[model samples]
Target: MRTAAYVLVRHELRLLASLAMWLARRTHGAGGGRVFGYARGQGAMMFGFAFVCLVETLTMSVLLRDYPTVHQMVFVLDVYTIVFVVGVHAACVVRPHVLDPDVLRIRRAVHVDLRLPVDRIAAVRRELRTTHEHADGELDIPVGAQTTVTVELAEPVAHFGFFGRRRDIHLVRFHADDADSLVQALGQALAGAVTQARSAPSPRPDLPA
Candidate 1:
């Protein structure tokens, strides 16, 4: 059930690729992958929340139309709005605790076919840990051992860490258990992609020849 929540959140995030891609292009000059990832994650979460809000609003509107008097309808709508907002807020706040485990499942689903470039593909491991202050938090991943990859979520934010920076403080964490196999698979996939990209000539000059 918790894993399912993470999958749902990630699915919601994937739906925002168009906007994320657009922003990535604009900020390509900023050299902040972490920033971009954070933005994308937050945007995705907001989009999901907004969708829920719209549905709730519509439902309330329909239900209120059947009320006999304006005072009764207004009182009912106000109460409903308050309850709905509070529930949404609480749900969003608690969502991470349920979804963290699903990250591993998502990691395994990536295409390992021969045609895809390995450089463009990366594998992820998610760790879920309980904290005193919060039930669930995120851990940051360093890209290629040098760059920071941001891990943010919809309701509760996770912890972020880079190699050698505050390493001791981690209580709850997720990682690729079979890291060697994952790296090998990703490397092979990348190598295959590189070969294909190189063999196929392209008009663009900036890309690797």
Candidate 2:
């Protein structure tokens, strides 16, 4: 029964996502922007969960509509509002990561925006597995991505998590369809940023008397 329900929820979310994508394309035209990475399966699962929550909210609202007590209606409304907010958050999470010239921006499903600087990226490498021994401070955008890119940072970056939790992360891991291509892009961007920094003239020093 649980598996059947899960499948139904996924189906609904996929339908909703398809409609939303179609509307977006019609409004904005094709080729929205260059997206570096996507949550893929992880995103689908989250959207499915969101769809289930939304359906439950609607059902509760309908059931409580005829209730005499005003508090009951208010409570139903509040639950619906919370579910709507969570659904919006899930939609945001399903959006792909936007790659800019100098920064990589990930709009997480949980309402967190992670912006990583290209210059601060120390190294870009591909790992066979997700787990690591020295992964004390690591950030994985979509957890459980098979083709993963491990980005080592030159300096520790403070990342804010859900519920006011903040931690310093030295590594950023994410799954990409084409891990090799992503690595190449990062390498080129890092090299360009480094070269630009080096070519810029330094401030002149004043002679001491």
- Candidate maximizing lDDT: 2
Query: In model 2, which runs have C-alpha deviations exceeding 4 angstroms?
Result: 1-23, 26-33, 42-94, 130-135, 143-147
C-alpha local distance difference test of each model: 0.34, 0.63
lDDT of 2 by residue, 34-101 (tens): 46544454556656676776677667667777774954766667665555544443454345565667
Best of the candidates, TM-score: 2
RMSD (CA, Å), each prediction? 16.4, 9.6
Residue 156 miss distance in model 1 (angstroms): 24
Question: Against the true structure, candidate 1 has what lDDT?
Answer: 0.34
TM, every model? 0.22, 0.60
